[model samples]
Target: MAAMSKPYYVTTPIYYVNDKPHIGHAYTSLATDVLARWKRLEGQEVFFLTGTDEHGQKVEKAAQDAGMDPQSFTDRVSQSFRVLAERMGFSNDDFIRTTEPRHKAACQELWRRLADRGEIYLGAYEGWYAVRDEAFYGPDELIERDGVKYAPSGAPVAWVKEPSYFFRLSKWQDWLLRYYEDNRRFIAPESRRNEVISFIKGGLSDLSISRTSFRWGIPVPGDEAHVMYVWLDALTNYITAAGYPDESHPRWKFWPADVHFVGKDIIRFHTIYWPAFLEAAGLAPPKRVFAHGWWTNEGQKISKSLGNVIDPLALIDEYGLDPVRYFLLREVPFGNDGDFSRAALAGRTNGELADALGNLANRTLSLIQRNCEGKLPAPIENPHLMHDTTLHSGISDLREKVGKALEDQQFHSALEHIMFEVRYANSYITQMAPWALKKTDPVLMLQVLRLLHDALRVFGTVLWPFMPTTMDALLDQLGVPKDQRKLADLATPLPGGIPLPPPSPLFRKIELAA
Candidate 1:
């Protein structure tokens, strides 16, 4: 197992602490949560991390606007993000806070190393700075809106000049391009990769790494008057969690992350600037950075004035956790923007979860309960259908396809493979007519039920990461022990005539007010 041989580390972009967590935050978390869970199910070691980005001018202003100090504000808002993660049923290994002492030490150490390596130098900077993005953009990158300048991303910007420490990012433009060229898969989805390459090719500028204008961030080592750029400070959290400066730390094994799950807006930071910073610090960049697109609520874009933003908690309340998780990944291509509508969401919940998978499990198990005397039948007494038929071959091929799809970060493709088998199982049951076979051919009926039960086993094993709780219930119906719920374990046939509990509904059709 790659996970056991070489640990898998994954991180969601540490969320900003300015507002309550939204569907956007949940989207990234859900994606990485599923990936991390899948890695663990592969019987490998995994470190799944998530946390809040506490310090920045945005946070500082938000705190002041609320009449509180930055620390209190971050602490308060950070708890909300943690609550969001917990409420969403996230199984994160660690939740890091930038305000924590260990993180502070990590940030300070990274700053000193970059400074010592000649990658950093004192400089004066003048540019259109977007506090919201914590980014400084050249005038050409800003859009004029009603006499004010906004970053291309729509965040308002201000002309600012200050003495700061700058990272020699311009010096590494060619090297960064070569890294992307040599490592073709460094940035995901092809579109994001092209965007980063174009931006770097257009030109790289030395990035201001220290901010004297903002006092709410980690201070530059040896110069308390200057604070580290929020993005720089935030990016260091990855290494801080990995125990930087102490290469022997057990967590450092996860240093070069398997993936960094981020939103499309931050692709440049992750793809261009982040890798360069790590190489300068004498560390390897994360293996892959997957930048996924945003979500629109219903048909309208989410906005504050429209009040159309999705609260993931409310979405989960209306639709169960697993359904929401499944819909997000299945509804859109992994890297494309998707629309979130209650109708679309509920349709998948009822159509896929209830009618397709849940119904298949219920009918197969109920048939076993009635005909097999509440016990799971042994592996098909007649093994032809179990090992040699088209159904068997089709399912056998799926494991490889789905694994490859996931390896490519194609979440929708992976789930599509599972659903294909699901529909096949439904058609197989219809064709077999197990209900009719029960009286005419009792022996054959028991064997058919056994085959269907085995099919459920396959679904349960592969679908566990996406729908853990529901899969647990379905696996229990097949008498699958808790410890043996992995892909490798599905091949072991169920012991003959083992007791299986009564079938319970795994997914209920959502009832909405008409």
Candidate 2:
């Protein structure tokens, strides 16, 4: 495989640290992890980043509510997110926090650049602000419910007046429109791109870039009285992971991120404010930002008051890590909202993973172990059968097919392609009647077994990025070496007579709690 010259940088938005880690956090991180691993499989250098957004008024109040100082509160909550990364098997290259000294420096430096460019100025600000969202809302955007104002998100809003530093967002309105038009794929999923364009065309207002009310954030450069806004501080975590201020650090090679995976709720901040901020700082904006939709639990909106939050840790404990990972991307189309139900997860786990994939590997390998002296059979040399030829051709074309789907971030489509091969292999084995061939024509049985082995090898290798642990164990039984698991290595045929390890179940069928 010819590797690309430039490194691929992928990031999950730094999660707000106001609450415990939930399914939304896990979904974004897992999606980014899959992309990072796939790039690595294709022989490219990859930098994956995930972290906690540790500043803002919401966090300050949360800290006080928890009876802890802001720093201590952030330290504790941020560690949980880090632990979530570990528990989910996320291969993030770095975990950043807005509270980190390196990140603070980067944020302040960006602020200075914007200010020096005449993009920032001190001003008195007043507007309806949602503390829960850390966002400002125009009167038109707020809905009155029971004589009380709430943001469109249904979060209650309160009027606040304070001296603040403002960014000249209105100045870049026309320029941003042209940028979006020139970089057609900059904002993803088509739907989100249109949403951003419409919002910008509606007219831009100067953004509040600093807050004097909350002291729990990065202090403004040359002015300690105000701290930089949370979105600005949080967004800088991307470049901070790439060594922003110094720019000479080795990791800086990954600047100008390949893609940023963010929840749709935050698309405006990322696509609008983030790019504008980077441009004001004389830096290039990230190449692409993909905003994926939310997940509802059992057809009900997930909320704390509703008591229906889907805890990913609990799901992993109940099911399995890899199964949860597979179901997450495989169950829903990319960039579309999905409903999470115990029934749907269990059905996918049992139907797709266990019945379709796991069974294919188990029965095929068991036959080879039992009938072929527990050794890997040689590749089929003379396959006059059209079924044999067709299966070989399909597996040969499988990698590129899956790659195209992933390039579009169509994760479900990528998995569907893989599962198609699995289902085909299962059907091929059944029709070939490898068990009967063992009695009628033992020689033909071995050839069929070899074909099955090759299919399994390709399946295990391609699936490694999505389900590493399970695929690792599956590949272990196939006698594939640790270093020989890249997508390029698929071109090399698996050598026969390799001592195969004893077969074991890769995924177990599980029952969810009532």
> All candidates' TM-scores?
0.98, 0.98
Off by over 4 Å in 2: 1-3, 381-387, 512-514
Candidate number with greatest lDDT? 2
Question: What's the C-alpha lDDT at position 393 in model 1?
Answer: 61
Error of 2 at 425 (Å): 0.6
> What are the clashing pairs of model 1?
none
Q: Considering only N, C-alpha and C atoms within 3 Å, which residue pairs clash in candidate 2?
A: none
Q: Each model's C-alpha lDDT?
A: 0.88, 0.91
